[model samples]
Target: MTRDRFSYLAPWWLPGGNAQTIWAARAARRHFGPAPRWQRSRWDTPDGDFIDVDEALHASAPQAPLLVLFHGLEGSSASQYAVAFADFAAAHGLAYAVPHFRGCSGEINHAPRAYHSGDFSEIDWILRRFAHENPSRPLLAVGVSLGGNALMRWAGEMEQSATQLVCAIAAVSSPLDLAAGGYAIGRGFNRVVYTRMFMGTMVPKALQKLEQHPGLFKREALLAARDLYEFDNLFTAPLHGFRDTVDYWTRASAKPVLHRIRVPALALNARNDPFVPAASLPTLQDAGPSVTLWQPAHGGHVGFPVSHGPFGLPGHVRAMPEAVGNWLLAQL
Candidate 1:
């Protein structure tokens, strides 16, 4: 497994984790190029639910590789990272698709179940379908945060079989240790900031889910939820077959399954990521040889802004996607 600083430096102006993360989410939008004109397609799930996929299809060369991006929690294809990667794919002559997690798309899903950190079955279904559709093209995947963990779980779960579906996988800023990350996000600044922001959308959507499926969960308990733990216990866990938050976090974590991955996998995280405790990250010995641990000293929570962009303002953050994309291609 590869480790150490592998070419990402946070701009000197933005040194802390929150600064990089917050800027990446908020301000980096202005720096990105025009958003791609997406070719949207809806695919019905096996459970009669649906997911929307935004595709930026361009083959600079015949059968150029396709990069599939999985967005973070409460995120969609319109996320800054997704746009950045889309811009990168266009510039480099590759096909890119961002498959929205059920409910992350504009519409609410039909199922009682929603996406979770260890939703590997969802990943398996999506990627395999992509591979089946484009048999001649190589498949590459990059997952951010929650998406990353889930993607990693699918890779480990599939083991050698995963290699047949994708050329390589890069998981950016994944909370591999769900228990640690979940716990961390429930406390102090993270709880006040991130947890609150997430709940703003999550609670309402969950309520909508409850409306769709009567008695899916307790409305009072869901409303009382002040953190992810409580919300997960009330909704995510029960709907997805987990006993509770603890059970869900324990069983869904990708860290335990890392040793099973057979294809080239990159687990990239910032030591200072607020949501993922640095101590929770796996050691070199903990994973299979196919895994590469790129724990850069900086680059907070998928935020890898350079000192300047071509526009010459600070907080240019596409470097993360580009570096990972190049790394994935190198494996081929």
Candidate 2:
């Protein structure tokens, strides 16, 4: 697929439109139904508190390969994409799991730490535990947006030797450069749309934490902050031990780690992604033998819908689950 810049500017309602606006608007609709049924469990971390993982099983076969799914920032097991993927997996007799990041499982983490776009340690913890417990079963992974970046980074750092159980991996619309992604979204119309919605959800959480812990975060800075950068700089960056947002973005972006992956991995990026700048193209030099950077002509962040029906139906999004599921299953 050719990475066309003009394609990204197309309107979202258009069939196969790759504009970031269209993608964001679809996600904003909230028309998707409740997540599919799944079994929820709390995995006690080495830190004492729990990280929640939701397992959706299609069969009881002891040797069935398990596909572990992860959601985007602030998403839980109930995210639309996660649930849709689970439903797709069920039809194929594939078992899956979605792990909620540290404080996102309706219960605040005991420590001040929360999840960010590039937190691979949490993934490492989950995968190791899952592999150790299910020695005979193979493990695969897929993540969306922020979660995608985390999974990709984890797979890359593994060097394909760390885990004999892992087979294939897929990541969609992950912002390889945090600073660039933030800058792209922090402008003109997009800035308002993104910041307002994101802050509305995040600020309340920060306030709740402040209420519980009293002095855990910067009350004044968080109160005055209006964008993700400000919020992260004051609350997320400091709490995560970064000196500044720029520093965090530099270290947390997955671009530096892409070349290290040794397993079959696919990265899907949309040039029209309003959140990530067009300048941050696939670093061809960094790609390895096992990596396939699938830069489609257009896909607004995650809106790869194949139709113009109500709620992006009858097209790409619906078809993607089957495609992704089949691809992963083939790898196993």
Model 2: residues with Cα > 4 Å off, grouped in runs: 1-12, 15-35, 163-165, 308-316
> lDDT (CA) for every model shown?
0.89, 0.72
Model 2 over residues 152-232: C-alpha lDDT tens digits?
Answer: 888767777744648888887778778888877777867777768788888888888787678887688788998888988
Error of model 1, residue 151, in angstroms: 0.5
Against the true structure, candidate 2 reaches a TM-score of 0.87
Model number with the top lDDT: 1
For every model shown, what is its TM-score relative to the native structure? 0.97, 0.87
The pairs that clash in candidate 2 are 305-316, 306-315, 306-316
